[model samples]
Target: MNLPVMRVLLAEDDPHDAELTLERLAIAGLDVEGVIVNNEADFIKALDSGTFDLVLSDFHMPGFPGSEALRIARSHPSALPFIFVSGVLGEEHAVDMLKEGATDYVLKQRLDRLPIVVQRALDEARERRSRHDAERRLRESETYFGQLIDALRDYSVATLSLDGTIESWNRASEWLFGYPAEEVIGRPGDMFNLPPEPGQPTERPLVERLAEISTGTSLAEERWLMRKNGATFYASVVTTAIFGNGGAVRGFSRIVRDMTDTRVAADLLQMAKEQAEAANRAKDRFLAVLSHELRTPLGPIYAAAQALDLRQDLPPECRRSIELIKRNVEVEARLIDDLLDISKIVNDKLSLRLEPTDLVAILNGIAEIFREEAAARHIELRYTPLPYPVIVQADPARLQQIIWNLLKNAIKFTPRAGEIGITMYQPMPGKIAVDVSDTGIGIPPQALKRIFDAFDQGEEESAQARGGLGLGLAIASSLAQRHGGTLSVRSEGQGKGTTFTLTLDDPAGGDVQAPAPVETPASPSTHRPATILLVEDNGDTAEAMQFLLAEYGYEVDIAENVAAACACIDAKRYDVLVSDMGLPDGDGIDVLRHYAPAADQIAVALTGYGMESDVRRCLGAGFAIHLTKPLDIDHLIDVLQRDNRS
Candidate 1:
């Protein structure tokens, strides 16, 4: 084995004794590097000049004693080992040297034992240093842990003993549990839990919890906990086991957070959601009832106008008056449709029937519908058809509705003698663009941003004069996006004319500048004259429809209610059944059930309840077709004239 090197400071007056002491130490397995100092000044200089692990000296020097050397060595910051070697020494002097902090004393006659004494002193000094460092680290760890516990103000932190006794509590624990550390320390950890309700089982015992946590796992719970004042609150508690250096369970740490407010907030939000759903249901019912009441009267009025328009002996002024009444009725019907469409969009219930349709055709048809009205207001309505068809995947009716709203808005806002232009072209390959520009009261710069927002009509005075619910642009914009397209507007300033641009993706297969297709009118039906049953509740609607059906070469019978319709069905056999959905006693579905037509007979439902769900319900109840009011006279005539020969 190799012996460790030791630096020794030798304080001796005789050089021979110093040499002999180092020789004895080296023989006894000590590696000694010695510096001999004969005087006190040399000894003190040697000690100050370098580092040494041990100090050796003679008992009596010429001018200095070993007692003085021991005193100087003990004054250093470290616990350096000091030993005495002397040739002549008394017991009294030895006692004095030992009391002065010498590690050991050996005489020259017993110099063989010097190495053992020196080795013992060095071992004891090293052990002292190890213990000192360990104690310092423990102090720092405790201080840091205390600061961390105090800094956590939101959670209640408590330490428990192996048996579940509260050992320490932080400041947050006092605030949350309403107890001071002095009162809670040494108490059972379960004291924070609320007592079991009457006749209920008690909580788990401390021994049970300790056994589970001894396996080095954590436990979590949420329940009511009682404070010091006996007031109870909900909280979430988590208990984790803390371990020692030897991997044994030392104790546990418990954390608690209040959860009463969070629970109450969740409940309140659920209640609010339920209330909103109820309000939405009520609004849908109100709109359905309102639609029926408003549209019921318009059916007969429109039928009467159609009947007069078919007259060949009316004066030109009378004919014009009839036309005005018919136009206003159609406008009213469109307003109702707008209200229902917005509701459907809001509820995410709006659906489309998409097909490859001609965009140019839709634009031309809508522009022609408004041309006469625009001219009456002294506005020039301009539209130049493309030679070829611009085709896109779209719902034909909904696509027409979008363009109709845009052109109608232009006519309403444009001043007399102002020009309203409908321009169509392809801005790029695979893209079709339509620009509806009007020299009208342009939108303000600030209002332009939110012009498409529902019910946000720019320039309130103009909107008031030209009355509308202001849902047109919002519905149009939403529909444009749904069709994989965009509707955008740009205007320089007020009165500078606004241009609305509608752009859509165009699929292949339509020629550029292709001529519009000519529509062929349906020829009069060549089938045998059919018998009809008309079920209507309103007197005017029942009578007008009866007269129109008779004029169209059909045997028509009228029934005012469910009982009358059943009576008419029992008395006579009819080939066609035309019934309004809303009757006095029951709905039209009841009449169809009573009629029980054969395979060749047809059942047609006419009503003002035009919601998508209503339409589905009518068709599902076995109606051949469902139509909404104010009735389309030509479509009804066409339905009555069809060949039901199957």
Candidate 2:
């Protein structure tokens, strides 16, 4: 319970009057502290010397009047409260004192009213100081904001009135347009625009921009603008509408930045991009021709190996050597396929034939294929599928390829007697997760960040020993994303083992009932012999395939080119026609058109071009089957036998 203290400056010729004033202020529960001065010199010195809440002066002092004291106190910078307390102050002189700057007057006979007058004057002084401080702060803030706008040397900032006349211009604006503030303050905002050519409207007039900003708030655009010297340069301009406190549109603010050099650089980059695309197209064409040329020689080699393998009297070592040759030829063909697949992916040419397929069944089958390879390295490869079918809309062949790549890497990196497991489970509702984990030397912390990047093999010595082009994970990751799934990897550190997870959407979302498994039927034990006409441009490939078909109990005729095949076709009708896509005279499509086989007769195409477009072309040309070279002999024989029975 502390009371407020009021300090007083008292001007009195007699000490008794000042004492009486202090006693009256104290009676009102105000803790009064007073400084007394008797003369004019002492009163003025007291006012300047220290802080006081209010001033009390006697009306008639020796050579000093309360009116003079009131005048001096009012003119002081502090705005201190002033009151007259005197017995000689008549009503007329008291009224004059308050009008001259006295806060209020109290007759000495009415000393009881002095406390009320002093208290009200103290409260009023406090309010005046608060208002003065607020106004000073506002003025300082506005000055600082103006200085900040002038400091931005690279941009021109201007303000426009509601009618689109310039109202304010910053220093940068003066430097940019070569006009002083006085000259541009009342000018139209469009004074900096480049003149329009005859019959051509001006580019995005100020009024049109303002109309858009009235609805949308802001607009940014690029156009050429004229400088003071009539030279034109590109500029990026941003204009925003200014709103008043009551939400009415008041004015607009515009910012301009020169962009002539940036515009030139952008045009150069666009030209470079076009040139790079053209170079990529040429590279694709070159690779197509190269693949055809490379696969042509492998056809003869592979077919001759199959022909040798068919001989039963051959030595065991000679048979094993032929098997090795066949296996390596297939491996080489796969390497070529990888190169072409990467090209297709980069150009967004890869496509999927999607269907609702059994995901668990596909994983189990892939695991079986890799079991023998894993056993050869003394690795325990394990994959256990769910009891029920996990169905998803996906391309089965592409899905198999993705899993094969992940498992292949796991086996390659795992040492002898290491463990590798494939697990599938629901990570959450509506999502399916497949994890391929291996007890191999794990990825280093630094390498894990970029493990799926193209051509980024880890810096591990073991990884270097297992050679590859480092495209498998990159291609698999990209394919996973294309199928609306994701591929991710986690490893603790080097030597702690690694796990690669592939996540996909579960189409049915929850547990589903199992469907009865469908069993595949066995192929026919023997083939029905047929007369076949073969067209091929490569002489070695033609001889090897003809000899192999003869061994398979088929009557085979060889034609070196499309014209020879046509000549043979015109002479006799054949049960089957085998032709190559690329020939010296023309392609196999021309031969098929010339042969014009009946609906009962079958046409088969063989070629080195295995692109999706090439396969579609051969099938659309009435070929019953299209086989890519270097050809798989067993598959071709099975195709002929199956179709022959039908």
Candidate 3:
């Protein structure tokens, strides 16, 4: 069997004590090899040879002491176990040496305990080295992790204890939340001014909230947090419960971002979209107005044609045809006027002529226009005048248009024999409300959300069900807004009926008189024979207009395109210049620029582009009138007659 080996370096001036300790170690069944040194030099030489497991020394020697020998042994590559075996030193001195890093010491008189003391010292030195190594490794790991957290730039990292106290704060956390590690660490999470309520503890503190979350009874919430300077901002806050090894609640982690700018930008974009949708609705309204006006003239024209075909008695048929033609021509004239009104409104060029107007008179006039239609449908349409002649500061014609559109909508939507009520009342001292209530198919809840949107009919399944290009309400609403009032609708839902209320500003100052109408010449037929220049790219339309003008007894000249029209204008002076907006060489605006006609001469634009903006462009370019095709023959005739007189 192999015995345990013990190599020892002995520092002593006396050889007898050293030999005695080695003999005792051997007697204890330790295989011992010993080197004897009398001073520090020999002791260090023996330690440097790397042949000893422990150093056993006398406390005092001739020139050196056991303390010196111990120091030398400790300075070696492997710190040898150091024990002071001394006879001259007292217990106090020996303890002093041990405290100075002497592993242990045994008195020379107690030779029996020397071997046990040496063995215990060796075991302790091994343990102390192992503990020192472990501590160094732990410090290195902590430094590495700290550097890793500091390197992160994007996200704020922090740790909290189970009690909601911050235990660790990272650099990113300091930059994002405006709190440094020194100020934030060891404080409760509420110090950062996060929600349940900023700068205040939650009703149930974060710890309890986390506990609730762990129990599957609570969800995290996002909210606005106030900054250190008390500026409120949005954040996407996410709270998650941290878990211990056994899956118990530890704490929570929260992440936040400022969303104020993002939300504002999103709102701005939404507003732009709504504006675009409003513009589209306006375009739809224009289409509906055009369709209505065009259909009116066609009704009489169709009737006249039918009458002429059915009658065999030539004299009566001729009279009926004459009457029919005259009526159709008048209807066509009104259609052209309404189209021009719609165009002006669309282009934003339709300026309101504001003046003091009797509100009752305007309502009465609109009611009279709709009375025949209401009578035909057997619907009761009546206006209840206010207690007094409630005068308002407004444009009479525009206000009349607003009321007429509303009444027409009521008459159109009301079922046969349904009641229509119109009432004007003073809701307040400075406010007047006009309520038009109808017993008809009411708006559905879903449709009401977008009822004022142009061209947005609640349903499109039936032609009658789809109301007038949805423009009447939109235009009426716009008009009300321009007049510093509001138009709003309320309904009980489908099949329940609906009411539209128009609230206007009451006249503050005293009322003024309405403007008198301008009367024209009695006989428009005896107008002067005027020279006319017509420019058109379409041969068929050009020929028809030319023939029509000649029949009306006017001198007519035609150009196929803008270039020819400009050349013609340069060569002659005409009473009126009629040109299509689009030509082969250029647009009508270009021709107008070339002609540069005197202000008194009339310039009329004829084109297919009927958008409000298109008409405005023509007027802005000095056109007296703008007309969209297919042309109204009688309106053109009337315009020619008027221009001749001018």
TM-score of each: 0.77, 0.61, 0.46
Poorest 10 consecutive residues by lDDT, candidate 3 = 295-304
Q: What TM-score does candidate 1 get on C-alpha atoms?
A: 0.77
* Residue-pair clashes, model 3: 0
lDDT of each: 0.86, 0.86, 0.74
Alpha carbon lDDT at 468, candidate 2? 75
Q: On residues 525-603, what C-alpha lDDT tens digit does candidate 2 reach at each position?
A: 4645688999987888889999999998889999989879988998988889999989888899999999888877989
Please provide the root mean square deviation of candidate 2 (C-alpha atoms, Å).
8.8
TM-score of 3: 0.46
Instruction: State each model's C-alpha RMSD to the native.
Output: 5.8, 8.8, 20.4
Q: In model 1, which range of ten residues has the least summed lDDT?
A: 508-517
Superposed by TM-score, candidate 3 places the C-alpha of residue 637 at a distance from the truth, in angstroms, of 6.2
Positional deviation of 30 in candidate 1, in angstroms?
9.7
